[model samples]
Target: MKVMFSAFVAALVIAFAAPMVLNQFGWSVAEQTSSASVRLD
Candidate 1:
């Protein structure tokens, strides 16, 4: 039971921390691409 609890806590911490870690290196799911152009007629 203790192992399961620890695993759950670790998973939660990783879930919350992964995004910030990725963004620290300029990697993010919301990153924008400049190659796509929009044409409005």
Candidate 2:
């Protein structure tokens, strides 16, 4: 039970932090899709 609790906490922290970490590198889902729409227009 202790090991499972620790693993759950670690996963929660990573899930919350991953997006902020990725955004620092300028990776974005909206930017990519918007550019494609502009090209089609």
- TM per model? 0.69, 0.66
lDDT of each: 0.84, 0.84
- Angstrom error at residue 37, model 1: 10
> Which 10-residue window in model 2 sums to the lowest lDDT?
32-41
* Per-model RMSD to reference: 3.0, 3.1
- Candidate 2 matches the true fold with a TM-score of 0.66
Question: Which ranges in model 2 have alpha carbons more than 4 Å from their true place?
Answer: 34-41
Q: Compose the digit string of candidate 1's lDDT tens values, residues 21-41.
A: 998987765565533567879
Q: How far is candidate 2 from the true structure (C-alpha RMSD, Å)?
A: 3.1
After the best TM-score superposition of candidate 1, give how far the Cα of residue 26 lies from its true spot, in angstroms. 0.8
lDDT, candidate 2, 1-41, per-residue tens? 99999999999999999999888886878755565435434
Candidate 2 displacement at residue 36 in angstroms: 11
Residue 17 error, candidate 1, Å: 0.3
